[model samples]
Target: MTRRAKRTRPATPQDEHAIPLQQQVNVPVLNLEWIKSRLNPATLERLMQVWGLVGRLTFPPSSSGKAREGSRRIPTADAHLLRKAGIIEEASSTITGGWIIPFSVVEEKTNGLRRRWIAWPRDKNRDDPYKANAPLLHISHYLPPAMAEAASCLDLKASFFRVSLPRETRHLFRCRVEDGTLVELTRHPVGYKAGPEILQIIITSAIAGVTTVVHRLWAAPPSVRIDVWIGNIRIAGSKSDATLWEAQVLRNADSCHATIGRTANRAPRSTPSWGCSLVTHTGRYP
Candidate 1:
């Protein structure tokens, strides 16, 4: 009699980047609420000034190529616990042979003022397990060259990681605080290789229905278009239409629990020299 072959489960895909675990194999998740509760009055005020609606604070890089020290200092007792939880790292001479990544700050010139803190993690970050693929922004040549008509541009607040990261991915955000305490970010931290890509994924997923609605409702005749680029959402249409669209977008943002920036305008208005054709969502040519 022919023996029946035994079926075996397929092997799981192995991740190329594996995080190094310390004595504590299982890292505890950071309690942001608790940490916030512990903040002193002065520190809290400092945080209010520096931090945006996003939990991230953007500090201009000093000549040394590091984030300028903010006025607020984390409580010493909380700092130790945070280190143990993998929220910060100790700047040790021995670990990684005393290698530290320097930071550079960039100012994004949108309608409002915004800055970003960038870190040099080399080409491949050992901590980042997933591949970083930024979502493509809407790029149609036919779209208006300038904000001639009414347009609303909204910036999402605290837009990074509305969803929780997979347990494996959480280990990637390890960094050293000023006190030399090693910490891992429970929430998605800025200045990581995969941060923007992951955040884009989250934002796209959340606003996918809204995108569909915008596409379906706005026809070619009306010349309404919605463009999402990273944290910015731009809606182009007539003054009234744009206002209504902005309201719809606000509702969508509320559902997604995303905060919108107060500033909304047609800041980059077009010059009189440019050719003026009936501007459609697809632009004049289309």
Candidate 2:
């Protein structure tokens, strides 16, 4: 049973500090709802007795990015986790003139076998308003430990389409698939302006959940972190810890078909950050 009152004193010598996270707690995917249920001020006051990082963990529920700029400095990892519960800005343009964006499915013939060639609609929304934005880690978020060696990549296949769309917005994503027939999207469309931000919400939740388990695992202290991008996630750490992190991610979400492959640990050759401003040119696929 959970205690209601806060613990006023420190853990006595008899307390088992060595107890592992797996043995202590199991947290599911964390979002605003999940955090509100237990991590609010009232509950956190009581939990401070248990976890004891209440001050660092506290953040404004609906605080915007601008609001956070003036607040006390929060550790990078914890700040990223707390952001999952904060209000996010929507980058999707307001629909006007009721016309669906035009699309075509012409896959290019280059690199036929190696790259994924899903039938993604070529969207013409470049001229349309797109405001998708998020707080992202620059490629050099931190320096790697010298002992930390290789890196690996995990691709969340067709990430945008995997997210289910609400009934009301489905019509806004209607597309023509080469044939004369029109199809309404039941899931988030790949080329849509709001798609990346929507996917970021869920991925952030998953990261918060997975990181809790990873940090408590025996292998965690010299931590091995798995960083995420729009669809591609990279797990970089010491060579020995790769399997440990991979296994935990798969266990966290069995349905996600995460493909593992060798990857360069260095930053991207193009501007060294994940936030890209260049609009995607029309391209063909399946």
Candidate 3:
């Protein structure tokens, strides 16, 4: 029979202690609240704006194009601390190189505006057809106080996001009261350099909720005459492709209606031919 090797005993403390260069490593759990508490209101406001625009929890890119990895990585430690504080979670490897937090986690209300958090995608190659950089929140065109009062009366959902185009683009687009109006209703400004594109994304997202309506009129005429008017003035001339696309959506919505209302603005009336001119310019539709 082969001789059995003698069993090695557990290392004694002396042996363990004798091992060269022993050091205690202290890893501190991150405190998310602590970080948040330290942020000044201005900083917090900026952070929220960035969050809403991006729609994600993310850090600025490191020199290496990825977050630093390894024991000494400061961001990793802060991320871990944030995780401990229940702010976000380490996403699965499929997402790679970032932590993810729910939109609701960092939501805050200020000056009666409800801010939401959003995440930006890591890969530049990824095609987010819906523009994700548009502002997520916006104030409706200054509604007449009476109309505002009427808006308050509608049996509307408790509160839903609203989108509006700037006064200029509204006229150039010849946005009638009826067509592709949902795109206009749901779209909002993306408070970033890429905001125009992102408006498309938010509109696309809102569309997913089939129960939601996208028309400018929140409720049907019987409930309230839509006291607001969307135009194509500054909207048509704007270089933003998003504004153009939104104009098309509005125009389409108008086409579907039997009687599309004309804008009170003179530009569209001055350029009656301009109503269908976008198709030629955008190369989209006629």
Candidate 4:
């Protein structure tokens, strides 16, 4: 009598780059309240200004590059996140954006793919002598002496995390998915040439805003300076008995997470959260 052979499941390959069937370890299961709150119109307009969205700005022009047609291939996992977040949507004939530049979806590897957006390159309008300036911005790489104490550096994901954009600029961001469908971007993109410069300005301004708030709330210790260096915001300061600035900074950052984006302040915080509070929410979000 022949014994029945045991059946085993097929093994799945571990190729991270494989587009199909790849899974993300962390998908932010759509917090409706959070999403709705962030999408408020008043918040969107202010966020645009804080993000340096103004009269004239475009992706860097490619000196050695030519404009590619359609969208580049996107990893399945990364594309899913975009759709879920409402970042990318199908274009309609009435979509009144100015241009339809193609974009690439980027990836963030973990237990699986995270996210990145395809970007970088150029364009020109009539009569404007195009200047192909180098895509370089000053990055402040600062860290206090550490004081050998309990100083912490919060890695804020300020760059390319999605924010509001003018509807007219819709012509500037477009993507063609694998199924031959054209898509449009509803939010600001990551991996663009201007990301670092814009973020540096915003985060630095956030630091200043926090500074002003902290100063007003408390009296002594005028040295309560917190710096968000490295083009990303960080809660920089000392925790010695001489001051409680670190604690105050963290508290203020968490508080500012929402109100900052809504207030009329020139340094409008795009997202309700920034700096340390965002670090704490890493597990809660993606």
TM-score winner, 2 or 4:
4
lDDT at position 2, candidate 1: 13
lDDT string, candidate 1, 1-286, tens digits: 1111133221111210121111121323323333234344443453334322222222224567543222223334444543564434443332121122423222223333222222233322443244434534464432335453665555543333233333343333334544655433444444555555444434532342233322333222245566555555556778677766566556554544443333323211110010111223434322
lDDT by residue for model 2 over 88-175, one digit each (tens)? 1121332211123431122222322111111232232333334445334563452232234545445443344344444444434333
Query: Which ranges of candidate 3 are over 4 A from the true structure?
Result: 1-87, 94-142, 147-222, 225-286
At residue 179, give the lDDT of candidate 1: 62
Query: In model 2, which residue pairs have backbone atoms overlapping below 3 Å?
Result: 91-131, 91-132, 106-284, 106-285, 107-284, 107-285
Alpha-carbon error at 185 in model 1, in Å? Answer: 0.8
Total colliding residue pairs, candidate 3: 37
RMSD of each predicted structure: 19.9, 22.5, 26.9, 13.2
Clashes of each: 15, 6, 37, 9
- Count clashing residue pairs in model 1: 15
lDDT of 2 at 15: 23
Candidate 3 C-alpha lDDT tens digits along 1-286:
1111234233233433332211111212222233233344544454345424333323444777654222211123333332343323323222233321111111112212121222222222132223433343432452233311111111111011123332222211111111111111111222234443322222221211111223333212232222211221112222344243434434433332211223322222111112212211333222
Instruction: For candidate 2, report its TM-score.
Output: 0.42
Candidate 3, residue 248: Cα displacement in angstroms equals: 29
